[model samples]
Target: MESSLATSQMSDEIVCFCGQSSVTRTSLTANNPGQRFRSCSFYGQPDAWDYFSWVDPPPHPRYKAIINKLLRKDNSKRNDEQQLRRLVKCYQIALEVFLLGVIIQKIWL
Candidate 1:
């Protein structure tokens, strides 16, 4: 229950003033991470409709802080996982090189 975003319902039946269908999308900005919103599907196109609405109510200050903290923790874990994978790969290559050297020494002796 870190966030209520998962339980929030997004409106897919929204329509823009210009008669265009609205698309539901989640926000990834620092200030509004994980928040969902609906906007015109044709937004930003030339001569297209522009509209926006939040699916979830504005988060309280406490909720915002909690969400941001969780996001930082998740990102750190991801970075650590990637670094570990790289380290393992380097070790594998070194082991292969060492085994090749040992084989060459045996053949020469």
Candidate 2:
């Protein structure tokens, strides 16, 4: 199974004072799901300073639900559009083949 944590190369701008880029993860709790943040590489070490930063604020539950719903709808629409395009291409090919057969019959006669 894939972990939910996202890995990124730490840049100079976001490096911890300890000179190491911290790993980033999203909160998966019921109250703070999808909240992104970064932590120091030496997090939890007795010698390391506490380092944490939020990359994005947690949205209201209602807002999150609405966003998820809209995303699902958008994905469904895209899949429908792709299926329609494939159907249209198949129809076009079939029409061309039929027309060619008709012309060949006329030529033989």
Candidate 3:
């Protein structure tokens, strides 16, 4: 779980087709959570699209379900947070409008 370890865990054996050295990445996908892979240094670029090699064996089935469930729960929490942010913004605008109306009424009186 150390991000520092992830980048430093290099495979001298793997060099991409583009001649860049491979870097290790942990998969976050539902099907293969926590599994490591070797990817091109030029990943996300046009030429490296096809470069991927597994560095670790496939995860056990039980662990896969647990990780996927955790990921889903985290995603749901983030969605709820975003919805709350929008609601708070709407309330702030409504309060500002109410204050503005009060000021206008006072001036007319």
Candidate 4:
């Protein structure tokens, strides 16, 4: 399944009652996974007016399965990236500590 960003771009023709362009978004809930809708860009904000429209109908069961699979893959990649960032931070700290120890030893000699 393609990302909502692309769909939002294509929804430029859709405008809210407030005169703002509508944006496409995907439902991430367990029941409506990957469902696409167009809503006001400010939809959910304090100043938002009630506005919503569907960009695509609910996917067929087989397509839903495919979208769910892609969602899982994307989530896994995000998790892996986060873990790598944490690991790199730890390595950077360790390197800094090691360099500090080396500097202390040189000063004592």
Which candidate leads the pack in TM-score? Answer: 4
- Itemize residue pairs with steric clashes in candidate 2: none
Model 3 lDDT per residue over 1-109, tens place: 1111122336436665555667789999988998999777766666454567788999999999999999999999999999999999999999999999999999999
Report the Cα lDDT for residue 76, model 4.
Answer: 100
What are the models' TM-scores?
0.63, 0.51, 0.72, 0.73
Please list the C-alpha lDDT of all candidates, in the order they appear: 0.74, 0.72, 0.78, 0.76
Q: Candidate 1's residue-wise lDDT over 1-109, tens digit each?
A: 1111111145536556565567788876668977898766765577665566689977777878888888899999999999999999999999999999999999999
| lDDT tens readout by residue for model 4, 1-109 | 1112223345447666676677789887555678888877877788686677767787788877887888889999999999999999999999999999999999999
Candidate 2 vs. true structure, TM-score? 0.51
- When 3 and 4 are scored with TM-score, the better candidate is 4
Residue-level lDDT tens digits of model 2 in 34-105: 678787766667777467778888878896776667667878999999999999999999999999999999
Residue 108's C-alpha lDDT in candidate 4?
Answer: 100
Please report, as a residue range, the 10-residue window in candidate 1 with the lowest summed lDDT.
Answer: 1-10
Alpha-carbon shift of residue 69 in model 1 (angstroms): 0.1
